[model samples]
Target: MRITVWDLPLRLFHWLLAAAVAGALITINLGVSWIEWHARFGLAVVGLIAFRLVWGVVGSTHSRFASFVPTPSAVASYVRGHWRQPGHNPLGALSVYAMLGLFGFQAVSGLFTTDEIAFSGPLTRAVSSDLVATLSRLHRQTEWWLYLLLGLHVLSIIVYRLRGIKLVGPMIHGRKEVDQTVPQPRGGGVLAFIIAVGIAAAAVWLANGSWIPVPPPAPAPAW
Candidate 1:
């Protein structure tokens, strides 16, 4: 009954995304000087999701979709109490994928959007104004789905916790015990973190357009 729950990369990505999302939320709400940081954090989130997508393809057996994602009938049966799982189950995997997809969409859209004032995404100028407007609208509208997905994720965790599930522990430790057997993980946590960081940095660099410092506007002539 034992199973490798989450790869170390996935676990760290989970927590780091949580923290970055929190920071983005706070900075956005705080306004003023924080919006810049919010954009920066969102960029980081996009990178994290990108790394995850790549990892899902190249990662360990337990981390790959071939291992966890199940069919609709299987997910339903699990919900109906007809089936039990040792790892991500079925419904949870779908939710995970949904969150990743939605968030990635949100972040990518933001990059081509403009604040409708002076601040523009690094690539915003590359697109037509009409396209920028659409991307901006999409980016803003996607917030609802992001909020809904986040709520569901939290609710699922709460339900599992109430059911005496140590879900968070396994994420942190990358191991779980089921039916007297201790589960072993597939990837090394440290290696995963290093890889994740490198991927994130590359994504951010690309998004920022080489991080070439944007020069300030020239001062207005004296009256």
Candidate 2:
């Protein structure tokens, strides 16, 4: 039977984030002025992730973190084929969390990173030089890991496709055919969506240093 596994909000978040990540990665390869765009894309990611965190709490059943965040016992049970429910499998849940963590770190770190040239993060001026240097280093170092995780995500999709599981279709259309009893999403209407978007916008604003208090101008140099 066909059942709704994802809601409009979750689906939009997924695709929009995918596009933002792709845009940021492309900017990385392009270099030069592209890094400016890369930061924009990264900020978009922050908004999406911020909304996702909120949605995970008060969103739909399948969209909720509680539905897919697995414990050690749950993972073991899934490995043993004891888990037959819908939504993310235990293994898939780990990958999902890992991806989110990676993107979250990248977004947060990018706020304070700088390339020492034309490129600087939106909030780079908000932090000390030492802290900016630290985050800048971390931002560079974590790019490789993010690529690795993205590769794994793609590989998992391919593997699942080969095994007759159509993960992509369900994510796009928000419905999937399954024998198990999969409950459709509840709540998460326009009001919840507006709230989530508001939170995301606020995060983006803060990350951009809109709320950071500006320091007073320095006095004239003593001759």
**lDDT by candidate, in order shown:** 0.77, 0.89
Could you give candidate 1's per-residue lDDT for residues 1-223 as a string of tens digits?
5466677677877898888777877787785567678789888888888788767766666777776877988888988987655667888789878988888887788788777665677777666899989999998888888888899888988999999987788889877766754446465355655675687678888887555566699999999
TM-score, every prediction? 0.83, 0.94
Worst lDDT 10-window in candidate 2: 178-187
lDDT of 2 at 9: 92
What's model 2's overall lDDT?
0.89
Highest TM-score model number? 2
Cα error, residue 91 of model 1, in Å, equals 1.0
